[model samples]
Target: MNFRKVRHVVRREYLESVRKRSFLLGLVATPLMMGAMIFLPFVSEGLVSQEEMRVSILDRTGRYGAALIADASPDLILTLAPPGMAEEELDARVAAEVLTGWILIPEDFAETGECTYRSGSITNLAVLESLRTRLGLSLAGAKAQELGLPSEDVESLLRPAEMRTVRVGHAGAREGDFTQVYLRAVMLVMTMFFALIPTGQILMRSVIEEKSNRVIEVLLSSVTPLELMVGKIIGLGAVGLTLLGAWASVGVLLSLRLGTSLPISGGEIGMFVLYFLPGYFFFAALLGSIGSICSAERDAQPFLMPISLTLILPVMMGMAIAQAPDHWVARAFSFFPPLTPSLMLFRYAIKEPPAWEILATWTTLVLATIAMFGVSARVFRVGILMTGKRPTLPEIARWARER
Candidate 1:
């Protein structure tokens, strides 16, 4: 292999990609899009109308109606229904938008605790939850009064305890914020997906275009297929790293300006890099091989789908893995080479796994990446100049096995 030729190829690939308008736009747009996705819900919540919910109570037992009206919050306009008012009347009131909902407390309330809430639309979870909570507290107080407990003691007994969580770690103890940990894990996984998949596709498309244009023939005059492949991977991988670095810098600046600490630690960031590089190389080599065999983008999709699914499945299961980092399924998947990057990152975010497990997964991923690169190089060497029909699986396997 001529190192000089490889260097030239790497320089050319890097310069060509970084100079594109799309790449320039992506550097600014990607972070803004991710920021909007993260914070938009909170902004939307603030925009929600603070209209008071008008509700009526049809208390058949005649015991809890006055209590509900008294305990209702400022946002709730609660009123007792007229004596002997039919269920149809309440439904009509809801349909007319005269009431947000109507609560039915049955006559045998002392024996059966079931109640029904009827509304035209049941999608307002906040209002539903508030009503359920207040109703439950009111029922508990009524039962306490029946048991001859003092009113003041009932209030004290029904009050919820305030609790705080402290997470003890190697660095010492700090207040635990599950939301921060969850968001950090999601961000890390998304970062890997954005950095790896698109860059890999770019590599694949570059290879296909070069092959289709017979440009590889000219390049081969100076560099071996292995050199060309390695150079392209390194150059594009550098592009991905540049993107990650830019995002990380922006995140650090924002966190500093906002007087907030980063949710991720230095060690976790190091692990992320370790997993990220091999994961990129593995997929890049796979995509590069697929690109080598095909003449067009359409021809590549059949091969690309499985690889795409492998990356996506881990993300879909991310919540489960984070919730139970030490579960057998998560632990087992952490050792699987294709899933190691995302699943292991999730586990690390929730709870750092054993050192040997991390080392084992990392080693496995590195070995898989090297093996994949070697196979891809052989396939590329054979298929780069082939131009007629797309090769079969067996033919591709034969290419990899050949000298």
Candidate 2:
């Protein structure tokens, strides 16, 4: 291999990629889009305030309306029914938009305590839970009075118990909330998973276009197939890193402002890069091999679909992974080279796996990446000039095995 020629190819690919319209648009839009996603909720909150919902209360037993009204948020305006006022009159008022909704306490309140809420507006879970809690407190107070229990005892019974979470890891047990752990896992996994998509597409499309246009023939006249493959992978890998770094910086700033600093350490970030670099090279090599074997972009669909689906399986099972990081199935998938980067990273954020698993996952991925690159380069050498038709799997394998 001519080192000078490989260096030239690398420089050309990098400059051509960054100078393209797509790359510039992505470079500018990615950070702005990430900033919007992070801060839009905060900006929109003050602009789009919800109007207070007015509700009428009909207490047939004359017992619970006061309790309900006391617990209502400022957003809920509770109007008690006047004595002798009919339910039909309240229903007419609701229909006339005089009230947003009404809560009806049945006459058999002491026996059943069954309540009906009538509203045209869709039910809000927060509001309904608040009303239920207030009703329960009022009924419990009544029951306590009947049992001659003190108000202090009733208050103690209603108070919720607190549970503090402590995450035990190599760094020792650190107290943190579920929100921090979940956010870290989601952010890390999604960043790695999504950043690979464009790089992989770029490599695949580059290979296909070069082959279809006979540009690979001209390039191979000066450089080996291995040099061409390595140049494209390195150049595109840099592009992916630049985009991801910008997004990560935005995420850190947003998280700091939101008071939920990401729980990932510098060591974790190092591990992320370890997995991502090799993982991207591995998948990109596989896609490049497919591109070299096919005559056109359309010819690659059947080959690409399975690889795309396999890559996406981890994300689809993300909730399961988070809930049960140590589960056998998650542990099994974490070892798979294609799924390892996202799945293992997810598992690490949720719950650190055993040291042996980490070592083994990386070992397998590194070996797989090297072996796949060799196979891709071999197939690429043979298939780059085969323009008439796509090759069969056996033919591709034979090409890969040949000297």
Candidate 3:
């Protein structure tokens, strides 16, 4: 409970972490890596050239083949294969890189509306969809001509309607899209991982190293285990903040350069900061406890693996959140203690959650953080001094409940 001792511990831990060459490199390199990863695809789009794809068509109908040949664009070239050419030969050509791919228009394509496409390499869905649309138009035109209707009339009948998405909430209607949801999910998950990992590693590594060196026995002579654990968590948490700041600054610069807006608004950014701190503390303490109860990093693996997977669960649900942000599953994850921060950040960006939900999520996180640290400190006190073997789960539980 000595404030002076806690401050000294904090100062030493922070200074040692910041002074490392790895830390200095991360301060510069991580941000640049983050920025490049986010923006480089967009920037490189104009610079990279795509070779036009040539797809051979086998027409059993013979009606739509000529229409497809005439409508071919600069990026897509459609050629009619010889009447007797085997599909096996065509597939071999595709495999040898002589052809990009091939499409087969069935005799019953107009009736069943199904056709087959084959490729040795990856198929481009955009190109395939384009080909389908063109074929559909051609069949419709042929049918219209037989009924003495003009091609323009058929085209008009087949035209697609436009629909724009708007999300309505207390703030009123706003333009919304799935892309924004995905971008926000990626940003939230990456930022959380980047900031949380180093701090957690520091907690674990410091605990393991100190135990191995028998330094905790010497340190506990001066300060209580609770104070030492708190000091380490705070010190390492500050170090993570530094990394987050550097990475965020560089990301902003890159976004500006790419003429791209960040997915989250100012308020969402504030909420991210709010949620991330407690989330980090919860995980850091859990990892610190694992470090304390184990003889080495290898000894921590069986325990650490579950925690790692739990943290990854929110990230794995990102695509589902992007598709249906307010679904019951997403809502459930948003309220879950371990996943609250990351999942809630995603929901906030997709569409603002109810205010009560936000409050509830934060309340759960705060309580979880406090309880986690309490348990962690208790385990650390006993396990930090025990070096011969890793503590059993029951023993660790006893330590937490010990007066």
Candidate 4:
């Protein structure tokens, strides 16, 4: 608890991290990757992309169906079916792979216009819909002209009505960020994916490096158990923060330059910093405490995996959370401390949840962080010095209670 010791540990952790190669590489690489992801949409869009499709037509109305093909597009190559060719024949061609797809003009073509598409290989659902819609409209327009009605009027009647919706909270919200909300949810998931594994790994390796060489003996001789425990937490935390900041900055800059600048506010960034700090510190302390309790790296798997999986669940359900932040499952986890800060922070940042909910989420996590650190500090102090014995949860609790 000494200010001098805490300060000394913080400084030592920071220096050790600055000297590591992993930290340096992360700082440089994160921004570039982010930039690339951001600009990729702009760079890759509308670039001669086609499905490599060739289409054919069996026209019962002869003129109407052939006209539909000619106007289809540069992408669609419509070949004329020979006279007396049957519907079965066109179906056979599709099955034979002679055509990518075909639009069948039924024999009852003049009386009713129900054109169907036939393909052996699956048509891209989107492309199929486009063909059906465009071709249908083209046929309908030609029929309307024969009946002395404007093709435009018929099309207008069939068009979907445009709508405008309003949300009650957070001014300046946009429709585009619906995708972004889902995307940020995705990013939140991926960030945790990238983060928890490596961070836990670093914790494991740090423990192994110290344990394998008996580095603990040298440090234990000079510092108290509390100082060593706190030192490792602060040190690894600095490394995590440095890497996170680098990755974030990279992603942000790249998005701004190359990708869509998803309408993120200062509050969202602050929530990320605030929530990530607790979520990560909570896990880091948990992991570091585990590392301290174990004599070997392999020993950590028993404890670490359960905790790791619990945190990973929210990230896995990220899309579901984004779609419905107020869903019972999402809301329930928002209150659970281990999942709260990351999952809720992602939800809150994207949608800007109710003020009371945001306040509760932050407050609960902050309290949990304090409580965890206290217990971890005690377990670390008692266990770090004790060798060949792993402490249980009851032992950590009893040690904290006695301390």
Better of 1 and 2 by TM-score: 1
lDDT of each: 0.85, 0.79, 0.81, 0.70
Candidate 3, pairs of clashing residues? none
TM-score of each: 0.92, 0.85, 0.88, 0.80
Give the alpha carbon lDDT tens digit for every residue of 181-236 in model 1: 77777777777777888789989999999998889999898789999999999999
Clashing pairs in 4: 31-250, 35-254, 38-258, 38-259, 39-258, 39-259
Per-residue lDDT over 237-325 for candidate 2, one digit per residue giving the tens place of the 0 to 100 score: 88888778877787799789999856577657977898898899999898888878888888887777777666657657877877777
Write down the worst ten-residue block by lDDT for model 1.
Answer: 42-51
Q: Which stretches of candidate 4 lie over 4 Å from their true place?
A: 28-49, 60-64, 86-97, 108-116, 135-148, 159-171, 175-178, 192-197, 251-263, 302-309, 389-402
| lDDT (C-alpha) at residue 213 in model 1 | 87
Alpha-carbon runs more than 4 Å astray in model 2: 31-51, 82-100, 111-113, 121-123, 172-176, 249-263, 301-309
Highest TM-score among the candidates is held by which one?
A: 1
Clashes of each: 0, 0, 0, 6
In angstroms, how far off is 59's CA in candidate 1? Answer: 1.9
Candidate 3 lDDT over 212-282, as tens digits, reads: 98898898888989899989988898899988887778779878999987655676678889899999999
Best by lDDT: 1
